[model samples]
Each structure stands twice: as C-alpha cells, then as structure tokens.
Target: MTTAPGPAYRSAPTTFGAVARHGRAWLPVIGLTALASSAVSLALPSVLGHSVDAIVAGSGYGRWFTIAAVLIGVGVLCSLIDAFAGTACVAGTTAWLRHGLVSQVVRGGAEGSREFDSGDLVSRVSGNASDAAQAGPAAVTTVAATAPPIGSLVLLALIDPWLAVAFFGGVILVVGVLFVFARRTAEISLSYQQTQGRISALLTEAVTGLRTIASAGTTTREERRILGFLPELHRHGLETWKVLARSGAQAAIVGPLVLVAVLAVGGLQLVDGRITPGELFAASQYAVLGAGLGSLTGVIGEIARARAGIQRAAEVFAIDKVAHGLLPLPPGPGRLTFDGVTVVADDAVLLENIHLELPGGATIAVVGPSGAGKSVLASLAARLRDPSIGQVLLDGVPLPALNHHALRTAVGCAFERPTLVGTTVGDAISHDAIGPVRTLAAARATHAHDFVRRLPDGYFTPLPKAPMSGGERQRLGLARAWPASRLLVLDDATSSLDTATELQISKTLTEDRYRRTRLIVTHRTATAARADLVVWLDGGRVRGVGSHQDLWQDASYREVFG
Candidate 1:
C-alpha cells in the first residue's frame, strides 16, 4: 500500500542553497551594493593615515579639507545604497518563500492534522518564512563586515610583516571559538523554535475546546497543561545565552591582547627605524580595527539563527504534494466507479477491496457503523484523497488523470462543520457560484437565505462579526456546496439541521431540475429509504448494495442504525 511521505525536511539542501535557488535574481544586486559600501569603508582608514602624514609634513590645510569632504560624500552614498539593497532583497525573498510554503501546505498528501497542528503550521509558515527571507540580506551584510578586517590586515602587512602574522594568529583563535559557539546556538535555537510551536499548539487547542473544558470543570487542569512547556522553552533560552557569553568572553580577552602585542611590535620597529611614525600610527589603528570589532562573530550568530529558521521553513515544502495527472476530464454525465479500492496505513486497513458503480444523476445513501469508512468512500469519490490500491473513475476516466480545475468544477463537498472563510455570506457562497442569481438560489435551496436576509446588512454582514448557531453554519456550508452542477458529496452535513429543514433540503436535491450525483453519508434510516440506492458497509467491506427497501429485510443491516 502507498505510505505517507517521509520527514518533512529530509533530503533538503541547506539554507544558503535555498536562498540561492529562489533569490538568484536579487542576490547579485545585494552583493554588488554591499561591495560598494565596503570599498568606501576600506578607504576611510587609508585616507586617515594619509591625512596624519600630511599634517606631520606641514601640508596645506586646503587639501586636508578636500579629503574630508570626499569621505563624507562617499559615506552618505554607501548608506543609501545599502538601505535600498537590503529592502529589495528582503521583499523579494519573503514573497517567494511564502508562496512556496502556502502551496505545499494546501496540496499536502494528507490532511494537515495528520502531520502538524494548526498553531505549529501557522508559526512555520509566517515566522519561519520571515526568518528565511533574511538569509540573503544577512549573508550580504556578513560579507561587507568581513572586508574591514581583511583590508586592515593587508595594510598592516605593508607596514611590518611580523606584526601582521602575530595578529592573524590571534584572529584565527577567536574565529575557532566563534565557530564552536555558532554550532551550539543552532542546536539550541532549533529546540527553542520547536518548543514555542508546541506551546502555541497547546494554547490553540485549549481555546478551541474551551467550552468542553469549562463544562467538564477542568479549567485549572487545562491551564496547567498549557503552561507546562514554558520551563523547557526557558531552559533552551538559557543554554543559548550561556554559549554566547562564553564566546564573547573569549573574543573580549583575545581582542585586547592582540592589540597590545601589535602596539609593542610597532614601537620596537619605530625605534629601529624600520617603520616611520605615521606608519606605526596606521599599524596600531589597523590592529584594533582588524581584531577589536569582532564583527565576524556577531554576523555568524545571526546567520546561525537564520539557518535554524530556514530549516523549519524547508520542512513545510518538503511534504509531498498530492500527485495528479495533467489530462483534462471529458464532458460526460456524473458516473463514478471504484475498482479494487483499498486504503491501509500502519498495518491497519481502513478500506479493503471495495468495488462499486454509481449511475449518472442518481442519489446514493451510504450507511455504515462508526468505523465502516463511509466518509472515506465519499472522500475518494471526489478525489479529496487518491486511493492507495485502486482507481476511482469519473465517466470512465480515472479521477487522478483529470486536471485540478476540471476536478474541482465537477465535484463539491460539504462537511458537518465547515470552515467559513469570507467576510460576508454572499462572498462565501459566491466563491462557488456560477453567477449572482445562482448564488442566491443556492442559499435559498439550503434555507440559509432567510437568516442571511435578517443579518445586520443582509448578505453583506462581516462573517467574523456575525453570530451564527451550528445549524445556521451548516446551512451556509450547504449553500456553498449547492452550486456544483455534476456531483455533490454531503458527509453528515445536515446532522445539525431540524427534521423539517433537512427534509425540505433533501426534496430540493432530488428534484429533476436540481438533481446531480449525490452521495450522502447518513445514519438516518428514513433518509436512506428515500435514496435510489443504498450501499451498506461493515468493517471496511461492502456488505450489500441495493435499494434501501431490499436491504431493510436483513436484521444485521437494521442493527447499523443502533
């Protein structure tokens, strides 16, 4: 049997590779601008050394002021270029990552609940995407910061080779310490991000089930459960800080020692007349600029955090999307057939060897025990999921062979509790409507129009602001599904509606002008009795398929309702 995909982030490249792949067009621009800024910055120290020599040599004040003006102008231009480059890189990468993440989530092979909770998924999609977007800019900034130290070292070598070698050794030691610290930070940061996601998931679950918890008098218990993850999150935070502190202490000690050593060497060279006074001054300044800034360590820390975030974001995209073919479904009547269908996971079979044929424009009622797989069959019929071991065909063409647009246009589904996602009732139903009149007709068919008309602004009322009961929401969901012209799958969608409303809606569905291929999952015997055919399921196997009256003669079938 087909299995779920592997770990979400497995076999993915590193954050740097991902940024290079998606932000290739923008990265070159960022790099060029950053290099320009570095050039301006590198000029500063050399210009200062030249100015010092000019003063000692009694050079005219006019040339000194002219050099100062050039320095100021270059600084301003560097700042503007860096700012614009950073903004553009961030904007471009953010959009690219967000689009990729959302597409993966929407097209995931299984429902999101099977892999990640809503809150965890939300954090990975939004927060992780933002962090991943920073990778390109952070890399550019790190490159720019690197220039001053390397340029300073090159200048020091020209003054005295011995001094440059000694300072380079110390810088290497500091870099080694930073490397160790960065690795530790990445581990701790990943843990911290996961813990925060768990906490968010807990809080979301608690809020969504607040009524159940409150009614059961378990408020304190639920609160305690939500707070339990805080200590673990705090521990991870403290570990990260400790690593940073150790690295900072090592750099702090190394920086001053390297500076002192360079000063001493330069002083000796000056006494020996091996280097001039201005050269000694420049050499001392370069030593401090090269080692004292510790810019590399700071930038490395940022890069480590971004790597952790990008890894999390990559996990989302690594989930395998549901595979479908490119063929367009042919226009035909709504005839569905399941040949040798089977669904199994982890040695447990949820459906097995199911074969059934559904006629065009006929209503079928599926009745089964709680675990008999009624909902699973409905999902297969509409290609909400592809079967593991069989072909589900629509009008003699396999459902998976049909393009996505054709599949959606040919089939619609309404659930017991629909997630309404629009600002107004009209907007929600209009998403699936052929036109305005069809939209209104759908609402009326499901008896949702009467209550919608009573809302504060009729169909224009904001859904979030409008109060709705369970039955009303079901009606609205039905209205949204009502526009399907070829097929409709209602999986317990009417369980909340009263008898009178449910009967009227059923009548409308059965009318010749409004009828389609209707697959209804229900436990109500009366509902099944009204269908053209009934498929009775027992323990993942189809026990019988016939008219409801024919099946009513069996005592085992009658026990399904109880």
Candidate 2:
C-alpha cells in the first residue's frame, strides 16, 4: 500500500528503543490503563478480606462487598482500555514502519535495492514490519504486566514481614525462568524469520519464472527447490515449541510455591495470634498475585519476536539510498558524457574506467560480446545507476546533480524484459504521464498501436486479459519510454520484435523525429549499421569508438555480432 511519508517520528529507527517510541503518544494511555488494572487487582483482595472479617465478626459487611464488586468492574474496564490502546499502538506503529520501509525501497530504486531480493523485500515490508511494530506495545505491556507481582511483594510485606520473605525466594526463580526464556527465544526467533524470508524469496523467483519452469518440465523440481528449506523451518518451529513447553512446565511447578509458602508462614502467624484471619486472607491473595509472573511469558515472547523484526528492518534502513541533487537541468542539447567511469560489483569489474562523449540528438549503437558491459553503459546514459568511480553528465550537469523530476523526464529507458505495471493496456503504454498525442504517436511509432486496437476492449483492456507476446510487450515498453525529451536508452528493448518491425522501429529511432539522443544496446548488426556512431566494447572497456562501417573492418568486432 502506497502512502505519504508520515510525521518526523516515522523515519527509520536504527535501534529497538527508537522503534518503541513510534507508539509514544499511545504509551501513556497504555501505561495508565495497565496501572489502573493492577491497582484494582491489588485493592480487591483487601476489600474482600475486610468483608470476610466483618462476616466472621457478625457485623455489616455490605459496604466492603460493594467496594469489592466495584473494584472488579474497574479492573474489567481497565482491561478493555488496555486491549484497545495496545491494538491501536501496534497497528499505527506497524503502518508507520511499513511506510518508512516502502518509502526507502522506492527511494533506493532498483540499483540501491539490488542487494535485496524482491521476495525478501516483500517479506520485510509485510511480515517483518508488522512484527517490528509490536515493539512499542510489547515493551510497554511487558513492563506493565510486571506490576501485579511487584505490588504483591510490597503488600505482603505490609501485611507481615514473614510472608514477604517467604514469597521473595519464589520471585527470584520466576525471574530466572523469564531470563532464560528470553535469551533462548530471541536467537531462535531471528533465525526463524530469516529462514522464512529466504523461502519467500525463492517462491517469488519461482513465480517470476513459472513459465520457464513449466516449459522445461522442471515444475516438480522447482517446487522441491522452493521448499528445500522446510526442514530447517520445521526444526526452528519445533525448537520454539520445545522452549515454550519447558517454560510452561517451569512456571507450573514453581508459580504455586510462592502461594504455598505465604500460606504456610501466615498459618503459623495465625496460630500464634500474630495475624488476623482477614490479614491472612489478604496475604494469600498477594501470594497469588506475586506468583502470576509466569503469565508474562507471552509478553516476553512478543518482545523477542519484535526485537528480531526490528533488527531485520534496521538492516534495510542501514543501506543508504542514492542521493540526488536539487539542481535543475541547464538548457542544452542532450550531450551525454561519461568521464572515466568504472563499475565494480563483488570484487569483479563490470565496467573499467571508460571515457566517452556523445553529442546530443545522435543515434549511438553500443555493441559488445556477452559480458562487454553494453547494458551498463546504457544504464549510465539513463541514470538508472551511478558509476563506481566517475561521473555521468547530461548536457553540462552531472546526472546526480539534476533534480529527480528533471532527470527522469529528460531520460527514458526501456529494457527487453520490461515489467508492465499499470492496470490497462493504455495505462501501461502511457505510464509516464505523457499526453494523449505523444502517447498515441509513441504507440504508432513502435507498432504497439496496431495490436492494442485489436484487443477485446482496445486500450482499456486489463493487462492480464490483453495476452501480448514478447515483441508486443517490447513495443509497449518502447511506447512507454517514447515521451523522453532528451535521451532514450534502449537496453536490448527491441530484441523480441520481428526483423521487419525492428527495421521500422529503428528507422523512426534513427530519424530522430523527437530530436532526442538514442543509445541502443543491440545484438543485431543491421541495427548497429543504422546508427550514426558505433561503440565496440571488448571485456569491460571500450576497444573502439567509430562508425559501424569503420568498426566492421575489425575481425573481433565482426565476431561480436556472431
């Protein structure tokens, strides 16, 4: 779901504490309600104890009973308030976290987010964000949930010193149970979520390539590959249950000890006439309250899960998006210049320091062998990515210095495997907000108009119902990119078209009716021959920069087309 950036508090937080503050506005309400619930719980025992004393003494106990009933109602009311406040806090914070994450993904764009798999990104944005958003409520609730036990300790001491002393030992055991559980669960939860993300990433990849898998008769194999991590996931799930079972067993055995101890000590006190029957009853209730620490297991588990999610989201936040400058483009022809550019990834050079300058309104063909970095060069022309060691200037301004709107509007790029995003065929072809005239012109120029008019609903047909072949989709992509005012970088964007259609499209592109610079990455020799200039690249560096006829004299250059 796309949303505008929220208030300043909605920015990505690098730590769990920062994530908790996303619910800061709701924290006080949650805390007050929780404390109110705890107070009602603590007060009820004394009221009931007093009523018991009055009944035993054969006096009026109606007032105390009424106060006890009122306390129960107040407790229920506080509980309802806590439930609503906690839910709102979690949901609001989740949305905030999600908004920040999705914004970052958009800001980072493809190049900045290339390190993350699409499926993995979906998992991070959907499940992980929700989990992380629980930090605020979980932290507050976990602390608030401890109040009853702590309050019981103080009240037990007030009633009789021996009762408090007896129950104190049990509280220590409860603390140990919580500590061990938190530590064990935290590690496992992180691993579990990471495994889930991996599986999600695999499933996403499979979906994108489902047609290939089916054609290759590897659907069963793809399914097996996608589910390969199930064993590990199952192990993690089993481990989590085991940890919960152990914690439960510990609580079941140890939680009652505090109550039994309090009762035993209070019994002795009662026998010696040191504590009244009412006081003993009150002390027993306090003991039960103190023993309730075991229930915090659920809250602690939530905190652990929240922490793991926070960590995952924080990693995404750590990746810096490519920064764009605010300067608008100065008026000039679309002369593109790459000054000593080099691109390296994973310790391997994709493009070595290469220098080239192409004049505006020229059709430049970049031809290369399989790994000769033709696509990378085209990407630079469109500013899809920045060079690792140099700068690309459109006209006179560095591409990074131009305002984003200016940069995007001036340079349009189309890829061979273009992903159509809009709902209808018209929407897809005109996604860049070009006017009807330009949109129709682009469609006609690229021959997409012919097929589009034949669709069942013409341009209004839904993309899923359009049933376009690869070449038709390429034409639509070219149409989508045709509105550029300055430069159009076609990265093998017409490879799927038949030779006849490719020729017509090439004629339009080379004629430069739009008066924009065209950088075409192509494997076809005819397309290269049509260009005003040819860039022959070998390995990651340019071997020659000349016209196609001149470059054709080289045997190695001829081999590039082969």
Candidate with maximal TM-score: 2
Candidate 1 residue-wise lDDT at 379: 85
**Candidate 2: residue pairs that collide:** none
TM-score of 2: 0.96
lDDT of each: 0.79, 0.87
For model 2, residues 411-469, the per-residue Cα lDDT tens digits are: 99999999998999989988667767877888998899989999999888999999989
Model 1 lDDT tens row, 389-432: 87788888888777777878778889888889777878888784
- Candidate 1: regions farther than 4 A off: 1-15, 24-26, 60-65, 109-113
Q: Provide the lDDT at 378 for model 1.
A: 90
* Steric clash pairs (candidate 1): none
